[model samples]
Target chain A: MYRMASIIKTESLVKDFDGLRAVDNLNLEVEERTIFGFLGPNGAGKTTTINILCTLLRPTSGRAFINGYDCVKDAHRVRSSIGIVFQDTTLDKDLTAYENLLFHAYLYGLKREESKKRIEELLQFMDLYDRKDEPVKRFSGGMKRRLEVARGLMHYPKVLFLDEPTLGLDPQSRAGLWEHIVRLPESHNVTVFMTTHYMDEAEVCNRMAIIDHGRIIAEGTPEELKRMVGGDVVYLRAKDNKMAKEILKERIIADIEERNGEIFVHGVKGDVCIPEIIRILGEQVLSVRLQRPTLNDVFLKLTGRQIREGSPEDEFKESIRSYRRRFDRT
Target chain B: MIELKVVYVIVMRELIKFFREKSKLVSTMARPLIWLFFVGMGMSRLVPQDITGTDYMRFLFPGIIGMTILFSAIFSSISIIWDKEFGFLKEILVAPVSRFSIVLGKALSGTLLSSLQAMLIMIVSPLIGIYPEMGQIAGSVLVIIVLSFCISALGIIIASFYESLESFSMIMNFIVMPMFFLSGAMYPLKKLPLVLKYAATLNPLTYGIDGLRHILIPHGMLDFPFYLDIFVLLSTSAVFLFLSTYVFERGK
Candidate 1:
């Protein structure tokens, strides 16, 4: 048993459901007292990875450690050192805020007096002390999310995991949650491992990984990943994609993708590339429009599609539907 | 020590939720009350005296108590489905408590609430001509408590495998209705088809109703063999509870 340190570390962690690999051989090292964001499109196995790290789900193979303890071999110790807030709200709808926090504290082995103090302090920190007696069923989306965070912190866990923390919140609620999440590290020095599909959330993180198809396709600071694109981006849309590509090629302009009636061109001299691209497209009987490429472009470059593809569950449901349709026809 | 505290917290959470759902309590009690008072009374006039060997209402009272335990236990099981749907169960599963404690907490809560419902139904039994000897009420409550635990364990065990609310309700309709009927809740199994009589004997609920009847009916017209019935019911509870906790551990 190593002394408690380095909040979370995983080496070649792999998770498979039936035949489909949900998390392929993945390695991650999350430092203590840092908010590390896991960014990916939907169905990129973010939730599965989070679940494994939290000890909610065991890995299919490979090793995971939390606070210097193996997730499987020392699961209880791993669980003791981490707290998780799932993508979905999980509070008992009938319990009061105070009761929820108190229950959570007790679950972590807090004494009665310690639980009372922690609940009071957390309620105050969340600005929910005034409404502590009201059941969670009455709280708004933001308050509920905040209470979830408070509940996660009730144990003073060495590491906190938030999976898609603001997927469905209004902008105001999202912003409010961001503030709370940002303040947590400064206030508690607890390591935070959060997963989000939102780019803005990723931008706020000190470091992150872009996951897709159950693999970490890229990992770095948001700045470093964006720098992978290496220049200003120009998106050229044309009526005739083949003609556009032909024209750009003829004019000696490189780094172009022609697909689905649009041309995505990336280069250092984006402004210079635009006019040349337009003039060539005009001669080739194709209408062209140009604009800058954002992170979406970086994502498109990394993966052939947009940031992520269709969710695995969606595909599973679709196959089920098709199977039902076949049976119905018979 | 902390596992017990965690279990207590979980039980309290489940009970608090139960009390808050006013409609749940009303709907749960409504069926047993209707079956016992209105349906059972009307049917009593039809259950010719020679066949049943006791007042028809009296025979139905123990069955009503069984029904109360069944529905309340199933109602508690619905929370398992609801929590899975709403993600609350996932949260609790991920908490520091052992998976064993999670199963124990839920079963105990269901047993506690269902027994309370049984007590409430007992309060009105005398007004309906199904009065038990005061001495037997305590034994009946004890039997019902164990039965409730058994039912709750079975409910949670069923919930562990199902993924959708619609499918769960479908299973409830198919399984619970037959368990209620074939176990002699509404009618005696001795008169049913031999196949059903054999099936009824397999139903844990048959043991519960027989055991309860042993204590709750007047002058012991129902020779239920009390200790044997209680032993069977307790064994059934033990089996269901073991299966439920095993499923819970694997399911998590």
Candidate 2:
């Protein structure tokens, strides 16, 4: 978040893939030199919104501009001003990592000398210089992702679009990638527009928009979004939740969600209310817990459902991913 | 409106990939060679000599070249499917290059690649007691280039709708085999029944094979003039180039 003006702006953007409205009338503004995150679950129109901004897909109606160029009418100029790392692996598996960057550079018409210089710098920046000449098929998932990010920056575009860059990465790989991604604003001085289903990934962004069913449900800095949930989450198992929830609502003065004989209270300052809740419920409470608001909780509060299928279910996908990895390797 | 530099970049990228798959180059020629040597020798003894005014292998050489280019064009178009599945097509769409530039670049590269394979098959011409004049070889290459351009565009346009290699090849087999067979690659169109002759004439490949016959045969074996081959192949290529570009620009 530098003191730069908006580089990406959309007004009433809509996209209908056949009869399905993948993107509703979306309005968004992203400043230059900042990492903006589109946070959502699967099929939440994150990729659709990115496609519109990148000028890869024409919107059914409305308008989008990147770096002052209209996405539709100024498609060529808009493309010149932005680079993208597709969610799917787009590199030539048969070609070396260096060759992939080479083709990308030439496609943008970078001068030979300048292309060489930039490719080296980016490969080194991504810590992939040693493996530059090796075919991408042999690279690990993390290395391939790093190469994709580097490819997206070859043109030195004003904005870089990454659609789920770290989707199936291991935790360590994800952290390693974010170190490079989170540094782009300061190092490359480029605006980054990215989409992700991972909560912690969204928390790394300077600003975020939570989209669901082709519409933005919430948008702000991470802290602001968490604050929108109104306060801390306090859940308690009581000997009598029916009695305790009613009593806590009268005494504690906070919003309470009663589910399956458990009392989950919202908007209460945990330290202040925990003591009061303990004293009031005294012997009737089976267990009490106070936790800070997480982005998952924020989504849960807004949509009344988890942002993803929860971390455990994601771990299942993660296992299936390793199976895919083995299959791809063989 | 097309940027030549972008076109060159795409063609260079495709060629580099083309060269890496040593197996692909070998295999493209192998199928046609098997037909030229084994099937042609076997069929030459059975078919009457006066019917062709030369051996069946000599008459079949040009048709084999046509088949080689046709099959090679279809195989070359498989790269487009990989381009889609691997998401390279998305990368190009998001780049500064024009869609028509991409379409022309791919079509031209495919033409060159298939022509190169067709040229390798040309090396075996003397085995059939036919010595190709340099002029004849150059003329045949030109015809192959245009036919490759025409067929590649058709394959690319068909491949555009398919995301998977299996489905694309499956659909291609159903279409490509009929296009080859109906082109009279294995028989003389002049001897076919009236309905079959009409169907053969409808195939753009019929003119290309006819062109190869005119160029490669010493005795005049052409049913149509040499220029008509160039005219039909070139015009068909122009039309497909336009259609494929339009379909690609629609961005699926």
Candidate 3:
């Protein structure tokens, strides 16, 4: 296999806010023409990392580069080679969809005729050409998201950065947006570096990094990351759970844990073990389930916590984190 | 050259938004006229003519032009607050264009809109029986442009510190009011208290209105030399523009 050069690289990037470290000595590399997902929970420094890469925020120490241009020193060149769809709606609500894209074209120094052609092509591609002349305020959340994605491609950038592209979108819209995003590398010949917390969304990436507390805990393809969970999970509910555990323990050498009345058997071939376990423990088996490891399970195995279950304490921490960011900026 | 184009597009977006909002256009145009007729007529009756050296309405005419530019120019930066609130500012900020271009583009648009309002007020000068000569009108245009740019830059400087429209309204009540009242737009600086006269001298609009008086009301009592007015307005606008650009770039 031919190796591809990194289009995005960061060398021990560190960003501190008033003595609180947001990103701590992070190193990341994303190859050209690949969809690289940065996966993390809220307050994981995802936005800060993307901001640094897009030249919106300067790193406190170390360096980052996009398309070979230093994010800090050669910010202008880096900006020119990249496009960004921020987590929020960055479109001018008062302007028409066409006008918004045109403004971007002019900012990027596209010629008048070329910009018009590109805007039309992008509007059509995003399925927004029919409503191109309408003000963006009239657009649905899904439509606005699509227009934003279209706007990000207006300059034919070498790399596109999406910070939570499907955040706050309905499941249908999320799927719809992903369809468009998945086709981007082939159609636009651009690398994608996106930050998403959704496990399902991260699965779509060609490669991904799972970050926590500003550090990447794991980085690999979806299959590789899942394989780290050891093996398929088998959940067995028997009439006598203690006897079942004893019997299963004698036959199979694997980690067995009980949670909420179900015996979870880990690191086993589910198909091979389920039949024997059922046959041996015949009438004692009440219910049995075989499951493959998902990205969520992998996160749970690595971090000992579910990714999506944000307790009240986590919400409080997130709010305080955001307040600190705002205070620091001011 | 690309930076210039970046500036141009930013200005264009503002102009397009300004023209689209008909109510805003009508209200901005109407505000000066209301003060010109209602407040000018009411105050003319209370003040004696010898103090102003002309009919009080004629004296208020130049002041009204100052008022128009002051309000229009400062409030134009509300577009910045609007952009911030709606997240559109991130689009411009993330672009490859220089921050100076962004500040210049905003200031130029504010200058254009405020100057347009100032000219519209000048057209209504006939209603007050004061017709500025063609030369006077031409000179006032230069003063108006300079003053508008100065005040708009001031607004952008304030805007850089804020992110919400509610904070902007607080600014309107605090900063905008004080600047307008002290600008000598409604009264002669010579007649003001000693401390206020000093405060008025520090105001760019005072120099601006004074410059307009030199051209629009040649016989009207002038506090400072016309050259000083021009000098102060030019230097202050340059300072304001630089400061605003600095504040924007420092955020990174």
Candidate models: Cα lDDT each: 0.79, 0.84, 0.88
Deviation of model 3 at B65, angstroms: 0.6
* Top candidate, metric DockQ: 3
Over the stretch B52-86, how does candidate 3's per-residue lDDT look in tens digits?
46888988888889989989988896678888778
DockQ of each candidate relative to the true complex: 0.34, 0.40, 0.62
DockQ agreement of candidate 1 with the native complex: 0.34
lDDT of 1: 0.79
Q: Model 2: per-residue lDDT, tens digit, A128-239?
A: 9999999999999999999999999999899999989998889898889999999998999899999998888898899999997688999999888988878787889998
Clashing residue pairs in candidate 1, if any? Answer: none
* Number of the candidate with higher DockQ, 2 or 3: 3
lDDT, model 3: 0.88
* TM-score, every prediction: 0.84, 0.86, 0.90
Ranking by DockQ: 3, 2, 1
Off by over 4 Å in 1: A2-5, A231-297, A308-330, B51-53, B218-224
What is the lDDT, from 0 to 100, of the residue A242 in candidate 3?
Answer: 90
By lDDT, the better pick of 2 and 3 is 3
